[model samples]
Target chain A: SAVISQKPSRDICQRGTSLTIQCQVDSQVTMMFWYRQQPGQSLTLIATANQGSEATYESGFVIDKFPISRPNLTFSTLTVSNMSPEDSSIYLCSVGQGTEKLFFGSGTQLSVL
Target chain B: AQTVTQSQPEMSVQEAETVTLSCTYDTSESDYYLFWYKQPPSRQMILVIRQEAYKQQNATENRFSVNFQKAAKSFSLKISDSQLGDAAMYFCAYRRVNSGYALNFGKGTSLLVTP
Candidate 1:
């Protein structure tokens, strides 16, 4: 089991501003994942952060909008640049191996005006 | 690509009664895993149960159990003697084995427990 601590449990931001969300894991892990949950919707993978390597993003997501930084095995950060109302969602960080088991942080809820 | 589906949007159960949440998935691969997660009003996601595709026996944890029908591609969660704490949003998720991929989750079903 892994313990993840995420900051800014909830935040309200204005349009065009950027917010950086941080995730810290209790144990060292090779990969960390970021996800987004829109209002009344399920979770969608935003990107996968690998230590010392560039983050891998899923289709329909771009790095310029959601830049990720993985400095070490236990820590990572995701920045939502140029926020918009559509960007309002719950951003979560998780660490784990494949399908076995995944542990999640408390999640950062962002509401953009 | 894999997809998970949960048909019920909401369910109501009397306290101490039994209720089942339905889930189905589409996947060509034979080896995989399925899980049921619970999210309370606090929005804390909790793992309720999991079933391996290869296992024939159903997985049970105290009052929570799973009915996994591999052939039908259906995995359902059954909660016996439901409590007030059981009221929450239930999500069904699927993961492929050995792929090291992220989970595919359903839209989720909201459960309401009545007194």
Candidate 2:
């Protein structure tokens, strides 16, 4: 199992401000992903972060809103741009070595005011 | 596209009792994986158990076990000796064999374990 550390466990920001969440993995991983979960809702895939390429955004999500950076195998970041109350959700970072199971971080709880 | 379904929105069980949460999924692929994740008040998603589609034998972890019915596309989790700590929201997920590690999650079932 991979251990992931997510910074800014939580934050409250003014509307229209951008917040960046960071995820660090204890070990190098090949695949990293970002997900969003609304309060009392299921997890929604936001994007897949590739080490050296642009992230792949899922349907209903756009790169302009959630920009991702995977500088290396051990780290990745997700930025929630132009935030709004609707952008308030728990952001999760997951790492997978291959087609195996994914390990998730504690998640960053964001609240837009 | 694959979808996971957890029909029970909420369920309750007494401490030391057994409880089962139902889950069904839709997938055209023959090889895949299923997982059950528990999220407590802390909001950390914890893996409870997982089942491989090609495996006929069920998977068990301590008091957590799963009933994987491949033909029926059903995977249910059974918690034996339920404890207060078992109270949490459980999500069912599916991952295709060929697809990258992205998992499709169900709405989730809130389980309450009471003494």
Candidate 3:
């Protein structure tokens, strides 16, 4: 088990403003994953962040909108740029021990106004 | 492509009674991992149980267990002695062992526990 912490448990921001969510892990991990959970919907992968490299975005997602920064193995940040009402959702960060298991953070709930 | 299906949108179970949530999946890969995750109103995804494709025996975690059929591509979760804490949305997930990067999740089934 890993202790993952995420900041800004929740926030209400005006449209067009950007909000950056931070995720910190107790231990160093090779890869950290970000996911979004829309209202009444299942979780969707946003990107995979690796230290010293650009984040890999999943389908239907792009870096221009959700920029990720992984300065080191223990810290990563995701900025939701040019926010819109549709961007309102819960963002979560997870770290994997192996391909089989992933431990998740508490998640940050964002509501764009 | 691998897809996970949870047909039941909502289910209710009496407290202390046994309840089973159905889950089926389609995958071309031979080895993969199946999981049952519980998401309460808090929105934190918690792992309940997991089953390896190669394992013959079912996986059990305390009062939670799984009935896994590899050939049938079915993995159902059984929660015995259901409690109020069990009332939440249950998600079924699939991940290819050593191949896939993220967990592919189902639409989820909301469980309601009644006293």
* Top candidate when judged by lDDT against the true structure: 2
Residue A97 local lDDT, model 3: 72
In model 2 chain A, the worst 10-residue window by lDDT is: A94-103
Looking at model 1, what is the TM-score of chain A?
A: 0.96
**In Å, what is the interface RMSD of model 2?**
0.8
lDDT of 1: 0.90
lDDT of 2 by residue, A1-113 (tens): 89999988999999999999999999999899999999889999999999999999999999899999999999999999999999999999998864387889999999999
Q: After superposition, how far is residue B37 of candidate 1 from its true place, in Å?
A: 1.0
- TM-score, prediction 3: 0.96
Clashes of 2: 0
Winner by DockQ between candidate 3 and candidate 2: 2
Q: List model 1 lDDT by residue over B1-115, tens digit each.
A: 8999999999999999999999999999989989898887666567788888999999899999999999999999999999999999999999898756578899999999999
**Runs in model 3 lying further than 4 Å from the true structure:** none
Best by TM-score: 2
Give the 10-residue window scoring lowest on summed lDDT in candidate 3 chain B: B95-104
Over A12-97, each residue of candidate 3 has an lDDT whose tens digit, in order, gives: 99999999999999999877999998887888889999789999888999999999999999999999999999999999998887
* CA deviation > 4 Å runs, candidate 2: none
The DockQ-derived docking category for candidate 3 is medium
